[model samples]
Target: MFDSMDEERPTASEPAVRRSRSLFEKHGLRATRQRIGLAKLLFSKGNRHVTADALAVEAHAARMTASLATVYNVLNLFAQVGLIRSLAIEGTKTIFDTNTSDHGHFFFEDTGEVCDIATDEIKFAGDLEPPEGYEIVAVDVVVRLRPKSGSVPFSA
Candidate 1:
């Protein structure tokens, strides 16, 4: 569980609080109470994929007063600041990933959960050249997967 630093001001002595503050400062964002609480929840569990709705449920379970709209806004902001990576899947559905490194993912279609795939796991046959006057950015590969016949789909 995250520390109950919502009511009180964060101090340097508290490692988690300090980390949260440092994250915001490093990303040029103001460490508001709501954002700090959400950050603690989002990051404390280590790297993983999360949706705003799922995070809202976790926040509610953790007794956080963040609304769904607030959760969505904060998640978008975090993605925009490069604190997290947003994966656009299934049309408008988005999953926020904590690990911002260069990597692909295994998208489970049945369960709608995403898993990371290392850069070495996938290899291109030939040189992937970009268009004229354009440099290649990151290659986002989302390999969608589904359970075969008689096999059960993994639960999220």
Candidate 2:
């Protein structure tokens, strides 16, 4: 998978790598080996999100030896490039999203896991306006939840 690209049509991964490089270059970021590897890891899977701790474990398992600080730096860099989005639920641990589209999240309180919720499933009927200088970019709704241990609650 590490084959070098030619002048003609490149491999699937090559285009992605080129796009990532362009994004990094546009954002005034110096593309490095670690940053490229981290970007590949983050964009390899579709519809996947992960926490820093989880990413560190994956990196260790893959024998990549990406330090926690390096992971955070890579994540921040990816966020800066508009390649991923970060969410901090309840002022706690932050999670990184691979899907950059407008969507919401669901936090499983019992497991402390986060999942993406489609934007089409939700509807807002009230007039919403942004603040003076800043325009509303995206909307994220995180529904705190817990697994049904026994019977589902009436309110649920």
Candidate 3:
């Protein structure tokens, strides 16, 4: 039986180190200490969405050294290499999602939390029409949610 929690999270286990190294190497990024530490923190937690500020806070809490700018750069790099998905929502807010699969998201306006919606949960009934020389690559659906009037506020 596996005793470590990392064992339960395959991508967070020992092999994750190898995976992260290879992923960075394949994309021509050096597996620096800060990069590896940030990668572990991002993947160790289950699928979730976080902003660069939030990641920086997590890094500080975990005692992993990384600047907010470095966090942003690493996140952008990861997104570029298909390691994570970037969601630009609520005007100037950008959230990084650890789950890179093609799926929809539920954005809670009040709490600024993002939850994944299964790919099949949303169905595109009508066909999409692209411009003269353009093709439809991907359609991202983000359902914004707000509590109804008189509803209880989100706790924690």
Candidate 4:
């Protein structure tokens, strides 16, 4: 049964907005219209992953004439600020994530769809250690994909 403590957790949406602003401020980033708009697009629903091409389409649909270069720039800025994470989805293109927390990803082999897998669900074996003074900052796991239909999936 779910306990009252579990029921009281804040909705995921709240943190995205709060974190967006805080991150911008923390990084001394100017709160430009383009930046805020992009932040909302990336984090509005709270840490969902998306591709640059997909985001460009969404921006275009919103009547925002942002060039691909601009999109890339903003993405890089966001990434630098730790406001989002980026991953190169195997057999596809790079994707952006608003969830900055440590986590793993899963690629639906049949659909080429990428999704986050809980970090706790992943177990590492062996005594692999980071070389002397180096620290393991982050880990990214990408699952290569293929469609079961025996037909190639469309790429963006």
Q: Which candidate should be chosen as best, given lDDT against the real structure?
A: 1
For candidate 3, the lDDT comes to: 0.78
Taken over the whole model, the C-alpha lDDT of each candidate is 0.81, 0.70, 0.78, 0.68
Backbone atom clashes (below 3 Å) for every candidate: 0, 0, 0, 0
Tens-place lDDT per residue, model 1, 90-128, is 899899988776678889878788898876877742388
- Error (Å) of candidate 2 at residue 66 is 1.9
Clashes of 1: 0
Positional deviation of residue 54's Cα in model 2 after best superposition, in angstroms: 1.3
**What tens-digit string does per-residue lDDT give for candidate 2 at 1-156?**
011111212237466667657656766888886776676666666557788888888777777868999999889777766667888895868888877766778887766778877667876323677778977666777888876789653331
Q: What is the lDDT of residue 40 in candidate 3?
A: 82
TM-score-better candidate, 2 vs 3:
3
Q: Pairs clashing in candidate 1? A: none
- A best-first ranking of the candidates according to their lDDT comes to 1, 3, 2, 4
Q: For each candidate, C-alpha RMSD in Å?
A: 6.3, 6.4, 5.5, 6.3
Off by over 4 Å in 2: 1-19, 124-126, 152-156
Pairs that collide in candidate 3 are: none
Better of 3 and 4 by lDDT: 3
